[model samples]
Target: MTKELKESDPGSPSPNVLRIILALRKWGWGSFWSQLVLAIIASIILIATIPFVTRAAAPNPNVPIATAPSPGIGMGILFTVIGIGIVYFTAFWSFRYTKLAQKLRGANGGERPSKLQTVKLLKTGAIFSLIGMPVTLIGANAIVGALTIKSLTPQPTGGYVGVISVQPIDMFVVQASILTILAHFVSLFASLWLLNRVSDKPTN
Candidate 1:
């Protein structure tokens, strides 16, 4: 049917286009559920981190509690970085999958993408996730830290009392974190589906 569609109408959408649509139709719900699971897990880890860090910072009861620094600038930068990474990775896989689909359109009957090609694509994705997930998470953590500062009010109680105030700019970090997390999981599942499609044996 896909081949017939391509042959019947020169202007019709390419076989690759149809493949993409089918892949989306098949994997869309799986993608959503997987992303939801990841988001829930990430939230749990984020929640757990707060108390651990708090306790670590004040291990001894005798010492006075130290003030944390304003997270505005640092978190804003980190968020921007992760946001860029998520976008880059998503865009990267989208382009790769589209190109692979187009390439497969010309294969002979029963042909499948070489194992090496599939492995390479998976490796590239894994490398990106390894680097990007950590960086994004660290940025999220910075936001958590920023949100949990002891006090923002000026206190003359110390040699170096840092400001703990939240600024309007910090909202960007929060927004970016939310978007990045969603994008990260959605892209992850979509990429997985694309990989499966590209690796599948061709059928008429």
Candidate 2:
């Protein structure tokens, strides 16, 4: 019933120790690494693509109805970056779970986090993801909508007037936003799973 009793995994003979070990060895690092890796990839995409989006091909002067729609869609890049930031924050919060797990493993009685504290942390992470989901969705939708409009935009008398048209890079914004959404979802799921697991324990 104390930290001194060493057990590496959840099959510990002691019930409370088993909970601590299971949380630490199973979901603790699970949440940390998954969120971290996804967030990093998403952020990199955001950084690489946002600048190009803003600098999207200029308006074709020859076309009378020269309306380059990509710039407007570029706005999604901003929103997606914001979403990525939120995702990063949540990922960091998820890391705290691992740290908390370590603390739980090494502490006993008053030294350990209360069930309330653990639940609160998990709930906070879930809420963060809930908030981020809409932001990322908005970004993804905007980018797709704008790109679609650009792709279908009627050209000047010619089939297509100029090179200032949709390109493969344009899709990167959508990919980034989607990845961010994925990261947020991962964080959200982990938080809820941990929350439920912690709730089932009868510890203060």
Candidate 3:
């Protein structure tokens, strides 16, 4: 019956088009959900980090805490925040593929995108993921490197509790950055795979 319908209806999608549609739906939704979950988890971790990160290093102002975090740590937080925003965008972009699939499957020719448009759309998503990869990496490196350094060379605090130690906040930033990296990776992989599927040669 499926074959008969295809044979009878010249407007039915070609094999390649069907395959592309399938790829879009499968990887698209899968990537979106995974990215979203990771992003949400990462966001929560970042939020949980605030108290630990902002805690006073010493009870008395005279005993002194560093006036500010090192450049690496500060930059890490900045980039991580930016990367999270990008992850959010990529998550939605992942969802765009499923919507594109729906459009491809519609009967209205006007609603269907040209092949070039579709490929361009996939490329845009791929490029965004590419951008996100570096951003998240920078954040991960900065945060982890700074945290490791602080852990190894803890400040002299005369054995004061909570005095400029890295342990309290290290895991929080590290975990969040790691999740963001994984989410970006998922977005990139799905975009590239779907891009390949859509770029394949069509069969009659």
Candidate 4:
């Protein structure tokens, strides 16, 4: 007796869509793992730099080190690198989510998404990522500046320094911190929504 073979549905995804989806799925894992690893590395670097900063700030009679200016610059570079790393990670996650959505649609045997759909996902993700960038930069600068200021003018020995004046830049930094927190929540929501949409699709 001859055996019957089952064929895939004619309405299933075309070769092009299937190929695109497979490519996107492959990229999703790469993007996620790379971003995660980079974020971890950034955190480690930032943490390790703290000791260098502290050593630079300490007063030492035996060693000839510029105790005043070095710590501030070191800290500034560290924070800036950290901020950039965070932004890059967030952007990677956003891009991954968008790709995952496309892949899900393809896997579900649905028609390939249009250019507009792709653009919309990217635009929404990018907007959130951009919003956080300035906040991160400002906070990092503020931290470096504050550290520098404290290091530069040490309190007089056996004498008290007068009340420190709050600068406009300080206020800007404070506001930026607040904004950063808000932007983080927004980005989180966007990421979750994108992920949820992808997961909800019926997969093959």
In terms of lDDT, which candidate is strongest?
A: 3
Per-residue lDDT, model 4, residue 105, is 51
Best by TM-score: 3
Error of 4 at 194 (Å): 16
Model 1: worst 10 consecutive residues (lDDT sum): 64-73
User: Per-residue lDDT for 151 in model 3?
Assistant: 52
TM-score of each: 0.52, 0.79, 0.82, 0.45
Off by over 4 Å in 1: 1-76, 79-83, 107-115, 150-165, 196-204
Clashing residue pairs found in predicted model 2? none
Task: Say which prediction, candidate 2 or candidate 4, comes out ahead on TM-score.
Answer: 2
lDDT, ranked from best to worst: 3, 2, 1, 4
Per-residue CA lDDT of model 1 for 58-171, tens digit only, reads 446553334232433355344545544454645455455544544444333435455477557655654565465566767777776666653445544557665545543344
lDDT of 4: 0.50
**Cα displacement (Å) at residue 137, model 2:** 0.7
Query: Candidate 3, residues 159-204: lDDT per residue as tens digits?
Result: 7544355554566787888899899899999999888887777756
Better of 1 and 3 by TM-score: 3
TM-score of 2: 0.79
* Model 4 TM-score relative to the real fold: 0.45
